[model samples]
Each structure stands twice: as C-alpha cells, then as structure tokens.
Target: MDTQIGCAIKASNELVKNLHRDGFDRGCIATFNDYMTTFTKNKASLHRSLNGINNAKNGTRLYDSIVDVIQIFRNRGEVSRPWILVVVTDGDDNISSRSLHKCAQETSSLFTTKESNNFLFLVGVGDGVNSEKMNEMASAGNFIYIHAKDFFLLELIFLKIANKITTSLSLSLGNLTVGDHSASWAEVQRHRNLSKVAIDYALLIDVSASMNSRVISSNSVTNLNSVITHATRAIGQSFDSRIINTTNVALLASWIDKKRGNPYNFSDLPFEFKLIHRASRDGFGNDKFHNNCDNKGPTIVVIKVKYSGEIIGGYNPLEWRCVKINEWSTLLPNNHDFYIDQQRRTSKSFIFSLTNQTISRVTLNNDAIIWSRNKGPCFGLQDLCITNNFGKSEQRSYENRIINKKNFEIEEYEVFQVIDKRPRFSIFYFIFMIFMGIFKIIKFIFMRLFLGIYWTCYIVYWIIYWITYWTVITLICVAGIGLIVSILALPIILYLYLEAEIAWVILSALFIYAPILGLIGEYLVI
Candidate 1:
C-alpha cells in the first residue's frame, strides 16, 4: 500500500477506537477503491477488516460506495437509534458508475422519511482532491463536508465528528455561569406545573437606598422619550425607502430598551449596524471618540440637534485616526493626500440630514473628509464638523448643505460601525453559478477550436497551391530540354554521315538554345 493509504488506515483505526471509547454501541466499516464491501457490525471484525486493507487499489468509486452503504441501511429495516455514515476519501471519484446528482438524491431522500435519523459526513483528504465537487455533493445530499490538508488530520476530523454526535444526543444546559440555556418553548409549555418543578434561580438585588428612590424626574423622562422617538425616526429615514417600513422601524426601535434604561444595544437589528460609541454613555470627549471609533472601518455618525430636534450625520468609509501633527507631517512627504487636519479623499463619504430626508454626497473628491484629534467626526471643509459636544454645518465640498445652522449644540450622538451581515450562499444560487461557469468554459473552448481549425485549413491551402505551381513549372522546363536534345542529335547524325565539322557547331547551338528556351518558359509561367 502507498504511504497515504497507510496513514488513512491508521486514522480510520484511531477513529474506531475513539468512537468505541465514547460509548458507541454498534457500527459498521466499509472500504472502497475499484469495488466496495461492508464488513460485519462486530467491532473486532471491523478492526480486522481495517488491518487487512493491505492492497491499495488504483480507482476511487466514492459515489457508488456511498450508494451501496445507503442500500445496506435500507435493507436493514427501521433503525431505532441515530445512525451516522462517514465517507472518507483522499482522491476524486474516478471509477464510480453512479452519477453524483443521482447519489445525492438518494442520500437526501434518507432524511425525508419521518422515522429516519440518519447523518452523513463526507471527509476529503489530500491536495489533489476536488473539494468543490465534494462540498457540492455534501450540500445536495444534506450532509456535512470536512476537508483535511492530508491524511494526518483525519484522526482529529473523525474525533470532532464523534464529539458532534455525542453532543447532539446528550441534553445541553448551555453556559451555566452565564445563566442562559436553550429549551424549546413548546416543551416548556408541555410541563404540568412550573411552580411544582424544582428550579435553581440566581437573583442580583441592589441593597442600597438609592434603588428605592426615583432618580429620574417625570420631565427628564419625557425629554428622554422625545429624544428616543427622534432618533428612531432618524434611523428609519437613513435607510432606503423600501426598508423604511413599520417593521424595520420597530426593529430599529428595539435597539434601545426603554424599560432597562439602556439606550444602545443593536443586537436585534436585522442589519449589522452595531452601536460602537454613544456620546451620553461613553462621554463626549475627543479621546473617547478616537478610542471607540478609530480603526473601526466604515462608521455612521448620527447626531440629534439640541433644540430643533433635527437629526444630521455623516458616513465615513475610511478609518478614523488621531494623528499627531509631527506624525502627520512625516506622512505628508510620502503621501500628499494623507492629512490629519486638512482632508482625506473618498467618494463614498457623505453628509446627510435624516430629519430633512436629504443626503448630500461629496462633490470634491480631493477633499471629502477631515480627521483631527480635537474633532469628533468631520466631513468636507466644515460641511459637518463635530467638536466635543457642539457641531457646525455648511455647504463646502459636499453636493448640498445638510443643515442651515452654522453651529448647533448636540443633544445626543451615536457612532455605529457598519458590518457585513450578508447571509450564507443559498444552495440553488451556488448550483446556478456552477452551471453558468461551466457553460462559459465550454463556449470558450469551442471558439478556440473553431479558430484553430480555420487557421490550419488556410495555411494548408496556400502550401498545396505553391506545390502544384512549382510542379507545373518543372514539367514545362523538362519537356523543352528534351525537344532541343532530339533536334540537335538528328543534325549531328546527318553531319557525321557527311563527315563535316558543322556537327560540333550544331551541338554547341543546341546547348545555348536549351538554356534560352528554359528561361523563356520560366518567365512565361511567372
């Protein structure tokens, strides 16, 4: 056997040992190359079968082997316990007669049965393996796919699978210290009496007298409510019109829990706009701003105008940094656009007034944004510059002015880091893209083939035409030379009969005429 197959066998033995140790009662072993065979469920017999795998075959019939195992399970009748089928291979399927799609359909049908508790895992090892096809098959088959760089990692992969199986079967209490657990609400409802059930509860209570006192006055609560309402409206207006519906507004409003007195926690937001910095909670200092917002890419700054209750903010696609003057000057020589006080260019940066429903994008690409240690968030040349808790707005480098006020006091401002929360690839989308890619590849191959044939035929035609022309010219020259020789020989015979020296003259003339006639025929052909 080859070294790779040997290592794989060793790993398989390790997997069997670990699964047996982990309280697994019964399991079967199967091996595949040109043909596949499933050994008896007896642990000792399976071990012997694994040890006896000395002949490493040349072909991998992976799909056919999986189907055979599935057929065996089908023939075994109904299974009372959960069954797992792990298929490990180090190479692509080269000898499988069953198509991948057909095999996938068969595997997926196993889960459609109400009594079926089957789990399939595809483990691919080695660099030469086609991981994409394996993953696709796994997805279509509704199974998990794990990739290992080499056979050495197979033991760990199998151990993980075993652990997953154990965990799925066992009761989970989640993190005990965090006091959070996962339980089906339907299951909880099925219980007869909640009070009769013994449960452990940990309650944190404040013993101080301040806990009994009403710290926030009724007027302050009213103002807080108004601010929250304005902020919620601003958030709703900030997004696209399609997403500004009532459901989204409710989701955005839920970011702040009024009952808990927590203003910023966007864990429930459908999109990823995490509130990273809140001026009221984190403090309204430039140092606090930089500490929370620096190097946190693509932040959205929302400000509530003090008395007017107008909401205005800017979006900075670049990271916010507090560069010292000396440090800034050093970078200036290397990069002309790298400035801490003057400007930073980004076409994506924009200032907006959510209250006015106006979005003003950057007009001057060279001077789109500015960063300063003393400023909170600045855009353009004082288009919207927030210094400490106060800010100013003007129509400088941006397309339109966001606010009419030259200076405004900030009531509340929040900085949120934009996060990419796009969902995972849909199986249908992945399959569609794969088919499109294949079609394009096939089209390109055919185009290249057609061009190659056309050029080949064109070159062959010129070659054959030249060869025919040269053959015709040679035939004409040879016929002319023979005719001159025959005529000169007759005259020489006659001259010999007369015993005259004119025969030598006629022979010399024949040589000269033959050369002249050949040259004339060559010129006429050209």
Candidate 2:
C-alpha cells in the first residue's frame, strides 16, 4: 500500500496516455485506494486526481472500484470502444463492503459475459498477495495477474501494459502452417504472410557473471563506467523502439526475481556476473533469481563472448572473441578507437558493417560473437571522429540470423595469416650488397694472375734503369784517370804485341780480354 499507490497512479496515467495515442481518448480513469474516489475523462485532471491517491491508504477497495468503473463506462457507452480495466493493488481487501465471492460473481457475469466489449486485468503487489483470490475476481481467459515488489519496475510494467493495450496485439498458430499441416505440428518456415513486413524476436540473455552489475553513472568522457552505462541505456532504448511492434520479445523467466533488482540488471562485475542454478530455491525464502516470471515465451541459454583482456588476464587492447564449447578461440585485437567483430565465419556473426557510413545505427545481436561495448567518446579523453560515428548513432540488430540455416567454417590460422601478413621489403634494400659482390669477383678471380705478373715486371724494370745510371757515372770518373796512362803506354804495348813471338802476344791479349769481360758481366748481371 506504500509505493503501490504511486505505481497504481503511474499505470493509470500511462493507460490514459496510451488510449489518447491510439486515437481513443474518450475514456475515464478511476483510482480506488481506501475507497473509489474520482473518475474523469480529462487526462490532466485524471493524472492530478490520481497523484492525490497517496500511500496513507491501508485497505485496497479493488472489487467495489472495478464494479463502479465498469458501470460508469457502460453508462457512458465506452463499452462500444475497446473497453479494458486494469486493477493494480497489493491483493489485500479489508475495507470493501462487497464480499470477495459476490465481487467475483459480478465480475464474471458483467465482464466475461460481454467478452467482446470488456476485459479485466488484476495486478498484485508485495510478497503477501493472494493470487487465487485475485484470479477469481478476473474474467476466465482475459485476465492477467502481475506482481511487482519494486516501484522502479512499475514504469517498465506500465510501459509494457500500455504497449500491449494501445496496439491490441495478438498471436495465433491456427493461421500459421508449414506445408499441409498447422505450424504447431510442423517446423514452419514462413509463419506470417510474406507480403506484410513484420519482425518478431526473442531476446535471450545469459545469466552469467556480468549481466547483473549496476552500472555506475557518470558524466566523464574517459571513464569506462560511463561508456558501459551509455551503451546499456542505448541498448534498452533500441529494444523499446525496435521490438515494440514485433510479436515476441522473450525475457528469461528467472530474471523476474523482483527482490534482487530490475530484470535488466545494469550493475558492474562481482555483483553482476553471479549465476542462477535453481530458480525457486535460494538462501532467502523470497524469490530473487527465481522462475516465477509471468512472461510466457521460450527460455534461451546464451554463452557470453570473452573480451580480449579477460582472455589474456591483463590490460589488453580491444578484440572480440566468441566463446566455444570445446576451447577458447583467440583473436587478434584491433588497435583503433572503434571495435568491430572481425572474426565472423557464419551469417549470424555478421553485424552491420561499420564501413557503411550511411548506416546511422549498429547492433551487437550476434550470439557467441564477441563485441566491445566499452567504446565511445564517453570512454575517452575527447571525442573521436571515427567513421562509425561511435556515440552519435543508434546501434541495433533485429535479424534472427541463427534460425536460418547456413554454415561456412573459416580457420583463424588462415585468417590471421592473411590479415596479419608482413609487408614486403624495399627493392633497393640489397643494392650495396649486389655491387660489392660484382667488384669482389672482378678483383679476386678474373684479374688476380694478370695483376701479379704486371706488378713483378714493372718492379724489375725500375731496378735495372737505376743500376745503369749509377754504373755510367762510375765508368766515366774512373776512365778519366786511366786515359792519360793508357795513351802513353799504348804505342809500346801495341808494338810489342805485333812484333814479338805468337806465344808472348797471345798471353798479353788474353789477360786484357779476361778483365774486361769479367767487369762488364759482374756489374751488369749480378
């Protein structure tokens, strides 16, 4: 009854707004706290009056108020419109003069009998709610009982309810068929008419370690906390806008543990990544991570992608690596301000191309495909003008790429070898080496013997020339002194050699010839 009053007023306000949005503003909202107090068609007056219904009320007059509102709508001919009644209370009725049995009978008779024109929904609040009693007050199949413990979730609850009421959305399996049988029995490819454009999606969240952390909010541009918060908020905003028209948006039933926090946990690590083993069993008797959620859709299990830093156990650069059942697939990090899931092999891993500048939005919807949510100007010293437009655009993905079957396996080794190939060396890098090799061949092998012989011949010729010059000088000086003596004795010697006997002349000629020959030979040759 404390915060329940505020939640009730909020819901009522949303319902009226939704009605006006759907072009059916001809309606009235009545708030029943301790008693059925006000009913008005004016939206502003209705909101003001509803806010006046405070937390002071002890008993919720749920039955009496519903009957009164139904009669009012009936009298005003609002029954002709798509009439619906939503009752939000703590499921406690102490002050109502009308008994629970009488209220149930009247609700069934008046609303259920006229099913086409009337509908009743009862929402219970707090832990001590009597669901069976509330169910009895509701019409057979047109009733829904919603329980909420936290008031923050009232906005989401009201929004969900408002979205449903305004759209009047419904799903049917009878009209859906695969081949010759109904879709319920067969694996149908096309569930709806292909001509009509409609997209339905089921959001599967992993109850892993990080999903439960409360995101610490900040205005700092370079803070990691701020980037994560912005990303998560953007993600939530995308979901609200993109999937509203779609039929199915499945949330994990275990996420309905209202005592813990909102279904969408925006907290940080240690507190965030805790797992849920049993839904209904825990230390506290209350259901914090329990399976009592009213959302009736298929529960999907997701394996979270490992971040590059988390994988290497240190401060690593941005890289996205998908988790594998058998082993961890290591991927190289991209050293840029923006991050893209580069190791995509299957069609499901292909998110929107960041290179496409025309695309104003992108989504990390691929399962097992790792992505860096910790990116943006908000996570840096200043904003970067990256091509992807990081924080300035919407990021979203709506395709159910997994359901459509296609397979292509690309080995990481092949991809790394191709993408990480080293650049080729310059052509002129070995120019000096080439020239040196050519010069060495010319000097050592081809010209070696010719150069040696030429040097030896040149040295011997120089030595002979110097020796001849010195010898000529010595001969001139010595011959000058001997010339005088030779001239005086030449006549006598010559006369003796000619006139004397043959033996005496031969001995004298031989001695002179021997000395001349010996001197010339020793000086020139030795």
TM-scores vs. true structure, each candidate: 0.34, 0.31
The alpha-carbon lDDT assigned to residue 455 of candidate 2 equals 93
TM-score of model 2 vs. true structure? 0.31
Best by TM-score: 1
lDDT of 2 by residue, 1-526 (tens): 2244544565566545433322223445454542333334455765565566553434456566666665665455434345556666654665678876555544444443332434345656444567556543432222444555444344444444443332232243345321221112111212222212221110011111221223232334444333233322322221111101000111121121112432222221111111231211222111221222112121111111111100000000122232222233235433423333322222222211111101111133232222222321110111110111111112223232221112111110000000112244455657877888889988786577888899999999999988988887776555544455445656766887779887876676665455555555565664
Between which residue pairs do clashes occur in model 1?
Answer: none
Task: Go through the candidates in order and give the clash count of each.
Answer: 0, 13
Q: Which residue ranges in model 2 land beyond 4 Å of their true spot?
A: 21-24, 33-41, 115-117, 139-142, 169-526
lDDT digits (tens) for residues 205-275 of candidate 1: 11111112222223354544443333233222222111112222222333221123322223344346667
Which window of ten consecutive residues has the lowest lDDT sum in model 2?
308-317
> What lDDT does candidate 1 reach at residue 374?
74
lDDT of 2: 0.35
